[model samples]
Target: ATGNYLDDLSAESHVILTNAKAEVEILKAQVGDYLQFIRNGYFCLDSKSWEQGNRVYNRTVTLRDSWAKMKQKMGL
Candidate 1:
């Protein structure tokens, strides 16, 4: 999906999901603060956006889906 498989720019699709809600503490997060979003992934406050007064978060890592992998291995 988001990963590029070829050199063509149209080969990859970019999706932006915005306006998801978060805990109140997220409002107080400073730049470079690391956060674990439940069932989602780890994220960090985007320093550049913070400097611009925007509460932007960049996903650092995706949560591992062991169950999904197991199911795939089993041909489910």
Candidate 2:
């Protein structure tokens, strides 16, 4: 879950996440490739979409949380 990722991040983790946008792109491609070889009849594939949505959601929450904390600290 996106909340889990946010809660799991530490200062060191945030440093690595500076390039999370790029890393998520790589992850998405890998996911797609994994899906390609599967022709299972019951694979709704909605889970794949959900994973991508989580990545974007994480990206947004990460930045937005940073901004909110900064604004609060600045009394803005």
Candidate 3:
């Protein structure tokens, strides 16, 4: 009877440990998903910054072109 009780206790302990391990695995997966989300946000922001820089570059090129045309008309 004592041996049977010990076996029951061991089985219960195994079930508890297995459940804890599963919980930890779930948390790890959540953390991984959060990291990916943060990385995606960073990349999106970087893309916006690049787009703004390109727009500024295009504006500068347009102004330069206009200046050159004005100079040509004045024969300078």
Candidate 4:
């Protein structure tokens, strides 16, 4: 989804991710806290949903695919 406010009004661009094996410490994350989801990217906890007792994270930046770069270097 896009991070642009005008492009994603209604928060409809949000995607719900399921992590059944996530660490317990994730539950302690506060609103506005930036978190890195391993191979995924950086995301911030949504404040509005946090106030409503929901865990909605908005992706901020995506992780660069180093593997893709390696593939390109190998001309594959």
Candidate 5:
């Protein structure tokens, strides 16, 4: 009876450990997915910021050219 009880306890412990390990793996996968999502968002935002900077630079250049043309025409 003692040996049988010990065997049952060991089997139960093994089952619990297996379940815990599977749960940990699932949580790890979820974390990985979230991290990748954050990385993608960061890249998207960075690209948008760069595009905006380019737009501002182009506008500034256009404004400067127009100003130069106006001054030349006005004999300044």
Candidate 6:
């Protein structure tokens, strides 16, 4: 739904919200994994993992915003 749909797009918003929630959960788990991996000293100052975590965090924020929109549409 891209977070800009009109009020009549609740169906699409619901679909987007479902997918976004799933993605958020997965990305959160991935971040947790990265944290554990880093703690194990697999690589110090690992740019790749840090970059991935940042990307996931950003996506999660967008998804959460989208979810908020969906909830508002649904009158929740």
State the RMSD for candidate 4.
4.5
Off by over 4 Å in 6: 1-64
Candidate 2 lDDT trough over 10 residues, lowest sum: 35-44
Report residue 72 deviation for candidate 1 (angstroms).
1.2
Error of 2 at 4 (Å): 20
* lDDT for each residue of candidate 3 in 1-76, tens digit (9 for 90 to 100): 4667765564433221122122343333321132122211211122343446521101111112577799999999
Report how far off residue 8 is in candidate 5 (Å): 87
lDDT of 6 by residue, 1-76 (tens): 4666575464533321223332343444433343222112221233465666543221111112577799999999
| True-structure RMSD, every candidate | 4.6, 15.1, 30.4, 4.5, 30.0, 14.6
Judging by TM-score, tell me the better candidate of 3 and 4: 4
Q: In candidate 4, what are the lDDT values of residues 1-76, reduced to their tens digit? A: 5877687666645566676467889899998789998888898898998999898888889899999999999999
lDDT of 4: 0.84
Number of the predicted model whose lDDT against the real structure is largest: 4
TM-score-better candidate, 2 vs 6 = 2
TM-scores vs. true structure, each candidate: 0.73, 0.21, 0.18, 0.72, 0.18, 0.18
- Worst 10 contiguous positions by lDDT, candidate 5: 54-63
Cα-lDDT of candidate 3: 0.31
Error of 5 at 42 (Å): 22
Tell me how candidate 2 scores on lDDT.
Answer: 0.39
Q: Which tens-of-lDDT digit does each residue in 1-76 have in candidate 1?
A: 5576564555223345587877898898888789998898898998987888887777788899999999999999
The segments of candidate 5 whose C-alpha lies over 4 angstroms from its true place after superposition are: 1-64
Tens digits of lDDT, candidate 2, 1-76: 3678777676553322344223343454432233221121111124555667743221211213577799999999
In model 2, residue pairs whose N, Cα or C atoms come closer than 3 Å (at least 3 residues apart or on different chains), thus clashing, are none
Count clashing residue pairs in model 3: 0
How badly does each model clash, as a count of residue pairs? 0, 0, 0, 0, 0, 0
